[model samples]
Target: MRGNIIVRIEHDCQDLPPERRSDLVTRRLRFLSDAEILDLASRRERQYPGRNLHPVSITLPADVLERLQRLQGSRWSVSALIDRILTDSGKA
Candidate 1:
């Protein structure tokens, strides 16, 4: 199996516009080769054994997170809450 493709950077260096304040923000993008892309995909298959790949990002509700934090205070902490729940469930 192969990993993600490795693209080469090839560009004739040039100066950016004066209006662009940050050098970091002003950057050029290079194209990736097909073979390199295939190699990368193959490598990924090997690295992640028997795993179905899926990309994901989650945004939680602010109030819910705040409530969770409130419950996670000094004495009755997050870990404690988890332990208590698990123990009460007779799983631990």
Candidate 2:
């Protein structure tokens, strides 16, 4: 998988725009050969085990979310807030 590696996932992302829920973006894409695809998968398995495979989700009242966002301002993201709560309560 040494020289077999060509375009990387990071490099692929670099050709695109930063992601935003409110904006549409396009990424430069290329067709990968089977060997390249296999290499990419293997590389990812080693590099980011369990990443995005399992995600936790929750639902809260719109007003509650809005209030929290206003209180925290730009200091915290909703994801970070949830992570902190879980950690603080030992649910993590």
Candidate 3:
């Protein structure tokens, strides 16, 4: 089976002058060819294996996130730090 192609556009043109913004709207944008799209999709599928790992999102206060990042420093990842804390507390 084949998957559908989805395109997303992200830009920071809000600060541009009205004339430039209009020009940007009328400008031609490049898109990936079908082969390129399929290749990228296949590569990403192989890059991320979705078997044992689950994804979770949590929002923390700015100060807390800053503290976490400081703790992460060079050796640990945010996930590793959180996992270690949970494991030590008998929560994980």
Candidate 4:
């Protein structure tokens, strides 16, 4: 689990008030120790094989890079945002 794990919390907590979302995430995260999380994640990988990601380097003009960084915002990684763009355009 070297990369990101997008855990979409779509269970009973989905209907909770927006104000309670942070508390829910905090409580759920606190319930697992680092080692336990790693163990469970390893087990999951064994159970369901998925695509592996590798790093790629790309150079962009300063203005384009700045715009991409701004569009990335706080919720998404640059890689994720690029993936989304490609996927939406049927290129990924």
Report the number of the highest-lDDT candidate. Answer: 4
Candidate 4: clashing pairs of residues: none
Tens-digit lDDT track for model 3 on 35-78? 43233222112344543432333334343434443432343344
- Candidate 3 regions exceeding 4 Å error are 1-51, 71-74
Work out candidate 3's RMSD over C-alphas: 21.0
Residue 80 Cα positional deviation in candidate 4, in Å, after optimal superposition = 0.4
The candidate, 1 or 2, that scores higher on TM-score is 2
Predicted candidate 4 versus true structure: per-residue lDDT over 53-73, tens digit per residue: 444333333433444434333
| Candidate number that wins on lDDT, 2 or 4 | 4
On residues 1-92, what C-alpha lDDT tens digit does candidate 1 reach at each position?
21121111111112322223111111110122433322222322235465543221112234323433444333343332322322333333
Stretches off by above 4 angstroms in model 2 are: 1-54, 71-74
TM-score of each: 0.26, 0.33, 0.36, 0.35
C-alpha RMSD in Å of predicted model 2 compared with the true structure:
19.9
Clash count of each predicted structure: 8, 0, 0, 0
- The lDDT of each candidate is 0.26, 0.30, 0.32, 0.36
Per-prediction CA RMSD (Å): 23.2, 19.9, 21.0, 15.5
Against the true structure, candidate 3 has what lDDT? Answer: 0.32
Q: Tell me which of candidates 2 and 3 scores higher on lDDT.
A: 3
Error of 2 at 84 (Å): 0.5
Better of 1 and 3 by TM-score: 3
